[model samples]
Target chain A: MAATRALGPAPSKTPDKPTDAAGQAPRRRPRAWRWADIAEFAGSAASALLLTWLIFDRFLPFRIQGVAFFVAWYALTLPIYWLVVRDGHGPVAARDRLASVLVTTGAAVALSPIFLVVGYVTYRGWSVIDFGFLAETMELTGPLSGADDGGLLHSLIGTLEQLGIATLIAVPLGVLTAVYLSEISGPLARPTRLVADAMTALPSIVAGLFVYSIVVIRTGWGFSGFAGSLALTILMLPTVTIAAEQVLRVVPGSLREAALALGSPYWRSVLLVVLPTARAGLATAVILGMARVVGETAPVLLTVGGTNILNVNPFSDYQDNIPLFVFNQIRSSKESFVDRAWGGALLLLALVLVLFVLARLAGGAGPGRRSRRKKGAAK
Target chain B: MTTQESEAPVTGQPVGGTLRGVGVSAWFGARKVLEGVDIDMRAGVVTALIGPSGCGKSTFLRILNRMHELVPIATLGGSVLLDGDDIYGTALPITEVRRRIGMVFQKPNPFPAMTIGDNVMAGLRLTGRKTANREQLIEESLRRAGLWNEVRNRLGAPAGGLSGGQQQRLCIARSLAVRPDVLLMDEPCSALDPTSTRRIEETILELKDQLTIVIVTHNMQQAQRVSEHCAFFLAAEDEPGRVVEQGETEHIFGSPEDPRTADYVNGRFG
Candidate 1:
């Protein structure tokens, strides 16, 4: 046909594309750090030192002489890229290369602190952590001793129970409130949104004080795990509500319209269609909210009043969480206590990493549509 | 190889219905879209609603089935009758009105998470018609929409994995699953390739014996090809839209009564 004639044969992309596909090209060499990379990095670093020398001697009073140089190096990259890359790759490619470099540098600078903290703690904490540190209680040993003296087992149980109660309280309330805000149209939507936004910024200490006054003083229960969990619930509700609301809002309008056209009532459509579509996002919200509050020492210290002995009854007695355990260990003036504090920090890091991995798995499969590979993995 | 002509035996008898709108006008918030529009879509015939862009042909189609009212700011000043009974009568539920009158959108919108077979069964399940055999219903609906042969082997695959044309046909199959009396389509083939468009057109012509259909389209030649009855809508310079002419498709295209209709059909102006 005329249309087929108009299409004709396609133009080749790269000269060797077809040959490469046919296995005509030679095998590739193993990659290595090459000579060109040295010029790029050396140029970037020298620019930083030169800018620091230019600025610190003349500009201002403050002695930001050390940090200013390292940061100034990033800004000096534009001129270097424009000078070194423009003639070879033209203006557009040169600009793209410069932008990529700037973004990569920014990412490296931002991530350095996280790596530094994990590295430092891992180095110090390895000595204290062992089979004994994981399974025993601090009740048996003195402040000055080896890994045989104490353990995080007691703290682990307290953290789990408190967080369980907190999850039990916050998840339903947050999901329901999000549904009301996103699905139902009513007079109370705006005011409820305002209140949730306000609560997200509520200081952890204030939540602890509020729970202390309302539950601790009224019931005369001094410091129980229940009170600590109540404070955690207060801190967690806003995060879950706001995130779940955002997820629910972006579920495409076409989907609801499709369900409605099938003669579904509003509530049934939301339950069957809208909620299922947002299932993964809702799981992410719960995990993130849990992570946000799990490291709180201020609220737990204020309410749960740290215990050294093993306790299981959250309803009746004081308990210890890892943050409170680490705080107490550091407060003691023994070298052994500092090592134990680092060991507790390492455990907390592992727990957080586990939560992130769980979140990634849950977030992998699309709410309604899963990749065949993901489905195979699930099976 | 076409899903048509095979005629799976889900329906005990063929079905269709009539729709009539009287003095219907619509508004979105403060802006009036349609003014004093009247139309009758009869059973067992294809009625094409045609106009230039923004002439309210699509709005009129949505209004016939009460979908316009779902918009938060939209208000309708009209009465629509389904087989002589007012759809707005307080005794009839909105759910019943919608179930009896089904629709296909401008774009293919199969539920992405659902399989092809499940997409066919969605309307039946949602509308509480569980007495029908689920397997027969899916097969008959896909056959009616002319998609059964291409997809018979992969019915359990996600509907989203199908190509655009197949997805559109799957949507048609989905709408047909409920066995509605009337089916409304909004520019069903505008987003498809020419081959898919021809296939959907053939399906439309074949489906005329079973359901009343009102299709909104901007393609004039397509209107001439698939429809029997044609209604032309037009609006001038910020004015509300209204029908200019209506009659048999052959007559409308050959010798229009109105100057505007003739100009539009002849491609002189929109």
Candidate 2:
């Protein structure tokens, strides 16, 4: 810590990352025109695609040819494009273009599924998601009910209440664990951190099974919303602790030192300085942990025992939740049930987005926030 | 200065204390930084510790207020007396020791989240010494730090709104609000511009009348200008840092007793 601090505040100017140390005075490379670069890339892609289609589709004996065609096209285009760029520009430009290509392809591959799911779900469900479908309950409806039959209000309420209980139990425990890991140091810190990391990788269904054994089997209790919350808390704790610890770790040692030097005790300094400074990050951690567990179905399936009707009392009886509701709908053979599953999935996505926006707004400003006060005006 | 006849400056009484260290040695894990360093800081005088980088002048400054022990690997040996009582002794709580001896860091670290007024009163509040006259206290501390005229209208604003110079002055005001007996500054102007540096130098000169001050500075000229007494630290090849010479500022600058001190004062070698 001292060695790094000794280096002083991050340098304002990095000298634009000093260019290669070649002794020769390098000539200024002209920037290729934007349209020319685009034209070059498009031409390369088209030629590669045409060649692949002609050679692979026509000449190959295999009936399954889409994957082979894609592979052949990519393999042929990369080297050919590299040579063309190398001729017009330098080796550095060629390398830069190749890296850009790889990154663009990687991003497209990553984003494809998200777009696919959103579009597919909306296409199947948008017509079914009317005011009545969202506001009423599914208690009277059968598995084969038509489009005008059921709603998700009961499930939505159950989800919100179960999450509330889980948050109440897990957030405090996770925050304390994170504080212990990041601030207080002792012999147990290493082992405690290792256990937390191990727990984070523990299967979500195992959390459900563990809670089922304790709350349902051992205590001789029926399936209830509280059981689901307990399982969710177990799943959420490790994630919240890990993320919160990372946030606390970067709260600048100087702030703590400043408060301690003013005669505040260690805990007091942490409360008045460290925690406040990391508030935004802690909010982010809580959001991430909540998001992870909110979409889980296996835990609720084992513990809560899904119901169709609204039950506001989480402790006394079984209750419906969004993921469990969607899971049950999708498993049915009826087309109406599948459309309901899609509607529930879309609603769940919107809920997460809304929750994130609300959390950010509630966080206000972190302790690291600099002065936002405008220049003093004449009175 | 405001001609308001307000009872503000009394909160920052400018009370001074006599500080003496005898054979102080410090270590971070196995690497010793200060080796048996001895110095005296008398009431209402400026004692400067000047050395090149890695010479442990900053380490010694943190030692005075027991801030050095906050680092887990750091260990200290020998006694530092404040008004004839050992600050490192178990008789007094470490918090009280820190309360009596305040520090201004190399960087102006006014808490970015706190308002200007809150930043000023932060030290007093931390020590649980915040009195009923907090409004007056903030005004006086800022005045003592030579920042009143610039920030008096915007006391409720965030401390970070100030320029680099004003922020350092605000930090000084924060330390002064606790009414400490001694003030320790570690290169307070190193991060500031020339104009801000000159203002801080002026604050040091004026503050010398009421506060016993120990400052660690890398700029030899700064040490000569602000400190009445000067201590030179040098780390010989493969040796921990130790004081080479100590005397009045003029004596150290004009005619240093040791050849090494003379060479350093003349800018021959750090």
Candidate 3:
């Protein structure tokens, strides 16, 4: 036994004694109850029940009752963090963890009203999303004209065309201006940055007015998709440029020096290295610019005079866009037209969501390729 | 072999002539950084510039390739003759000069988004050397830098994934892929570990047979170990940076002609 102890046990054998100061078996930690987590769970359940009751119960208007429920739910959950978790009366591990949960739950409850509004719109708008509603133009004179009369196909096509033209004009100009202001050091960059900052705060209506003064009143060109696209471009250029510039500025200086030191021309370096490094952020900026311009009713009203039929040519005649169609229908006193307006709003929201999803997918794909390459390299 | 004997063949060789700077001075908007500096770099050899921080060793290296002109306010007086032609002549394009003389920064700055292969080929592509087989060149360059086996399978991976030592070797590979006649490295091994430093020192020894290399370093032992010739830069009484002495590395370390060089090499004062 002494020889065995001196040599230690065989490698495959397990130790028989406990390895602790007390020389007894190790004690398992007791799981503690986190009150703040339980409170958040209870609060979410209460909010869901109240929302369900408000929507299904015949005694209350969903709009008013739903909003009130969310308000109360948020108010109740907001203080749980301060009262229970922040006071640290609970177990140490539970305190910090539950505090985060309560705070997040409070924020979610506060934003619940916006979710309710979107749900209501989507629910009411689903009925008009069939093939007939999508394939026909709104040139008919009557309500619920099934398959042969009215559809949003024309407006959809026109909206895409107008936005495309607007992006074509805006993206290049915006990116170049941003690059100049941020990268090139000169006496003019300061003043140009100031102008860009000022332009960021310019009102959308003011942009429309500026475009109207230049392309409409001065040039004697009547309202058309081309003019509207020009107006939207004016509104969106500053936004995209500012966002792109900020993203580009955040790219580490080492990357730039690496490319330049490799004998790459400055412009080539910007094109191949700098641009691809910030491609995700740039894509997000472009999508944001698209979202800003796609729903501008004021500019479309002032520039692209609403037409009942689709006009494929953006430069020549008035064109129909979803937002303009919705605005025109909403102003009419017909209930059927109002329903169409709601449906159009839903479609526009869906379009923006799709763009957002595309931006996210593209961003996801770039980094995925990088990580996959890393894994392959590791092996 | 003696220090003078080892340097004799390099100084006298006529294949690719030596680079010589005479009465060289650099100024940045009326601030003088280097004053009346004169040095000669023997062809196809490693010349180490050893100095304290802010002694303008890096600035002097940049001047060799006309890289200082990248700064809009930077101006230089005097001539840098490369293979008998004046590099500062108005007729020579700055881009062409940089292509023939590549530089690596103090920090290893491989393009973060680019693949290792792409980073190595960056210089060749920029100079429009399209006929060069990219894969072969990449493998050759990485092998020369002693990084081939480590990164061979992951040629498509981002260069930023490498550790600091690997990144520095990648930077050296990038400079080598351009096939420049001269390579300027600014404190290449300062940010690396001992093993990495030893590997780089080996790579430098292997490279000096083919291309002339000028390196700036703060470590005196590294300078003594790797360089065939060494230049000592120090701050003057009133001026900031001037070359005190430059000769064979062994002579400069063993028995220097100047007192300042002896003091610095002996660790008396910087």
lDDT of 3 at A313: 86
lDDT of 2 by residue, A132-237 (tens): 8889888999876896689888888889999999999999999999999999957888998999899988899999999999997799887889999999999999
Candidate 1 ranges beyond 4 A from true positions: A1-37, A40-106, A367-379, B3-5, B128-132
Mark the 10 consecutive residues where model 3 chain B has the least summed lDDT: B1-10
Worst 10 residues of 2 chain B by lDDT: B1-10
In model 3, what lDDT does residue A241 have?
Answer: 90
In model 3, which residue pairs have backbone atoms overlapping below 3 Å? A136-A151, A137-A151
How would you order the candidates by lDDT, starting with the best?
2, 1, 3
Candidate No. with top lDDT: 2
Per-model lDDT: 0.83, 0.84, 0.78
The C-alpha TM-scores of every prediction are 0.85, 0.88, 0.80
Provide the clashing-pair count of each candidate structure. 0, 0, 2
TM-score of predicted structure 3: 0.80
Against the correct fold, how does model 1 do in TM-score? 0.85
Report candidate 1's interface RMSD in Å: 2.6
Please tell me which model should have the higher lDDT, number 2 or number 3.
Answer: 2
